[model samples]
Target: MLAIRKATVADCELIHTLAWQTFPETYKDILSPEQSEYMMEWMYSLENLRKQMEEEGHIYFIAYHNDEACGYVSIQQQGENLFHLQKIYVLPSFRGVHCGSFLFHEAVRYIKEIHPTPCVMELNVNRNNKALKFYEHMGMRIVREGDFPIGNGYYMNDYIMELEID
Candidate 1:
């Protein structure tokens, strides 16, 4: 069985460890080693994670399979009715077991409870990511494309996808 629980600031280390392990696996094919290393420090550093959870109001959830942590997801409110799905990842070994879907639905459920009606959830996925079809399968459509610079000359070439919450 798959279960997901809200993550607290205390779980930062665990999340960081998972990010370090799974990120490379996910981006190894699309990103060079230097780029991946830079991104890991830029996004998953303990200080940044703390800032995201503490100051930015980003909510995170960890997914577990049979009591073992396997994935995580995070979301942050972007506006009155807009929530950004900032992150969603499942360990490679857990990929086929619907862990990502579980985390995605959890984020949606949380958004519905916190946000008002007529809300929408958005996320940016790399243009070359294999998860593009998976996001589509989950009812998201690419609304636009962007090349966001994240320092050190690195840019996130992504498709900005959104799903309306009914």
Candidate 2:
């Protein structure tokens, strides 16, 4: 069985571990090694994870299968009724087991729990990512596209996708 629970600051290391395990594999064919390395350090460092949970209002949830952690998702309220799905990743080994969908639904459930109103849930997904279809299947539609700079001369060429929940 799979279970998900809200993560606390104490779980930063766990999230960091999950990111290191999943991010590279997810982007291996799409991102250059240098860009992947830059992103790992930029986003998955423990200090940044702590800052995100403590200072940036991002909430993370962990997915566990048979008591072993396998995936995570994070969400942040960007406006009164708008939320950002910052990240959602599942271990490759768990891909066909519904872990990803569980995480995705948890994010939506979390937003509703906090705001209890009609809202927009948005996420940025690489334009070349295979996950694009997953988002569309989940009912998120592409709203725009952009090349967002992430420092160190790296740019994330992505499509912004959104789902409105009422």
The lDDT per prediction is: 0.94, 0.95
lDDT of 2 by residue, 19-131 (tens): 99999999999999999999999889999999999999999999999999999999998888889999999999999999999999989988888788899999999999999
lDDT value, residue 95 of candidate 2: 92
- lDDT digits (tens) for residues 84-147 of candidate 1: 9999999988889999999999999999888758798999999999999999999999999999
Best by TM-score: 2
Off by over 4 Å in 2: none
Model 2 TM-score relative to the real fold: 0.99
Misplaced by over 4 Å in model 1 are none
lDDT of 1: 0.94
TM-score of each: 0.98, 0.99
34 Cα displacement, candidate 1 (Å): 0.8
